[model samples]
Target: MNGDTAALPPHRPGSTPAGTTDTSHIVQGTPAFRRTAAALFLAGFSTFGLLYTVQPLLPEFSRHFGVSAANSALALSLSTGLLAVSMLIAGLLSDRIGRRRVMVAALLASSVLSLATAMVDDWSTLLVLRTLLGIALSGVPAVGMTYLAEEMDSRALGLAMGLYIGGNAIGGMSGRLIAGIVADHWGWRWGIGVVSLIAVASTLLLWVQLPPSRHFQSRRSGLRELPARWRSLFADPGLPLLFATAFVLMGVFVTLYNYLGYHLMAPPYGLSQTVVGLIFSVYLVGTFSSAWMGQQANRYGRSRVLGICYGLIALGIALLALPWLGCMAAGIALVTFGFFGGHSVASSWVGSRAGAMRADASALYLFAYYLGSSVAGVLGGVFYTHWDWLGVCGFVGVLTVAGAAVAWRLGRRTQPATGELALSR
Candidate 1:
């Protein structure tokens, strides 16, 4: 058996070859493939939906809790910060246990926590629940990517990852829209409660539909091996750049949305919470862009498509700087498009490049990804507090430009000659 065969699960009666290089992988147009896709889609949906539900309510939290805008953002920042730290451990845990088991437990626990968050009256208690929610959510994203990398056909990986991320887009939009609209009629707590209930439904669907992993090979090494695994990933020229791209892309995207509601609610715009939430409906554009651009990456090149996405993001930021609301709306749509597309390309690239280290590489990538969300997101609030919207814009602009530079550098790197470890260059 070759390296590819060795990486796959032990063959049983009637099993196909393992790994994306052969027909054994879950390919498109098959029932198994469809089930896996649907399962992962729900995973992305529930995880992101639960993570971002508190975002649109930041302003509402400020009013109810009698805190500042920056302080209110802790509800999100705390979750993401803890999430970033927890994913490193979660990845290793899944290696010891099983991917599906970890993800299922995570979804159930997080949904329960979100429901509890809806009932909390104290600000500190709410923050505590959100923090634990982050730890619960850590099981999904990294492990899901590793699952796709292990089980899906390599040729179809981009599209599969895109669909999963498309689910994330819809979840994010729906969560914000639901929370904002319901909060208008009832209260922020009601908005959260409704979202929590929806998450429970999604969790049940995922539990029933997702097939057991057929290609997974459990690792015996524990945290003692983590440092070496991470070092190998960073030593790769392209992987580190891809990780950096994840950081900036997520940070800039979160920062823009974090304060957008506050900006529209104040002064000349003075839009209601419902109207501000409606603005997030723009995330629908992300659903399309992620799949479309993922296909584009498969056809053209991952790096090339990623650079275009960064350019679009920078241009959107420029449009947002204008005082006109129409321009700002268009800018939001463009930013949404760019962000989802860039994320799809970057994440798929990491999977394709990581080879045997898929789990560790994905975990580290997301660690940076959410770390950016935690750090830059809160920092953007500081900019808003000081120089208002322009300050926020400037801060995000710098991050975008820096991310674009990294994408450019990665595009110039040469693909490795080894077939099993080759990247789309």
Candidate 2:
């Protein structure tokens, strides 16, 4: 072989080979990319579908298991609590092992735990299973954001991320709906069994359909690296804001959802669990809002879109204070849409703002995201007990306003913003 033709120049880091079109059908928009998106969508759908499946079945759990309101709600609270704690480790694990493997393992294990939860006879055992499932479920969100950041081209990241989130919106809607309707007809056990079965199938589909990560470069793992990564990201001003935004926004969103079921089930409303559960079908609005808002954020600035979304969230939460069911549903829908749209923008902002330490930054943001869920979520119980739905709305609505205020500050800050924060708006 003649040495006349020289070896190709080393490709630039973060640069794909020139003129190679990303034609994957599994991604977003493109046919090739659609399949990829679908796989992750299912992964998103199933993880959340199974994760929050028990939320609407709380009333049935109370009656069957002989527990109180807060205890019945423990099924979801315990899972989110454990999920928040596991995310830190899951992100680090993905950085070392690759996103696909970690995500696949997490989904499958969570599905198995859901199956176990379905069979448990004791309420204590059920909580333990939910917590275990939550721990297993951490693999998805911790790694999914990192995967999107690295795998998708910068030009395509927002749309791709939105589609993955669309999957989440639908999953959250369908999970509660199915659990409530089925539990109403048959029983809570059947409800759990059905969702768990779907999760098992979805796990297989995620593993089989999602492509292996070609862009990921596994990192060197160590405890020292964790602190170093944490410090490095914290040193970046943009990251701390992103992390805090995740915490506050998520806390507010979960708190509203955590107690909404209780409010609808009580005196004034006195709605059947199935009817109340169907209200969560409004989460479909999030699917539409996320995709459209993401596209607009890509065109405009993410910070700008995010502030508007948060404002909408505040307005919606305030409106829910009204007595009419129609107004309440509308308000919930607005808040749901705003939450998804804002999350889509902010979460992507974290990836764009962090520069080369993207995975670490994403993980930290999610760590805050889950911690908010676990902490504010349980604390929300106090508000519920003392003040009822009005109290819950006030607490959550204020957090939304605070989140918007932070985003406003981040949006207005001056230049010389180091790293990806300075990337083209």
Every model's TM-score: 0.94, 0.92
Candidate 1 per-residue lDDT over residues 214-294, each given as its tens digit: 677777878888888788888888899988998999999999999999999999989999999899899999999999999
**RMSD in angstroms between candidate 1 and the native structure over all alpha carbons:** 3.9
Best by lDDT: 1
| Per-candidate local distance difference test | 0.89, 0.80
Could you tell me the TM-score of candidate 2? 0.92
Off by over 4 Å in 2: 1-29, 414-425
How far residue 398's Cα lies from its native spot in candidate 2, in Å, is: 1.8
- State which candidate has the highest TM-score: 1
- Name the lDDT value of residue 337 in candidate 1: 99
Tens digits of per-residue lDDT, candidate 2, 1-425, equal 12111234422235545788543212446654776788878988998899889888876787889987667767887888788778888877887777888888899888888988888889999999999998999999868887777666666788888988899999988888888888878888888888888888988888777766655666777666688778988887567877888899878887788788888888977988889878889989999988899888877777788888988888899789898888888899889989899888888887877767787788788888878877777778788888988989988877887898888777766233443444323
Distance from true location, Cα of 424 in model 1, Å: 3.3
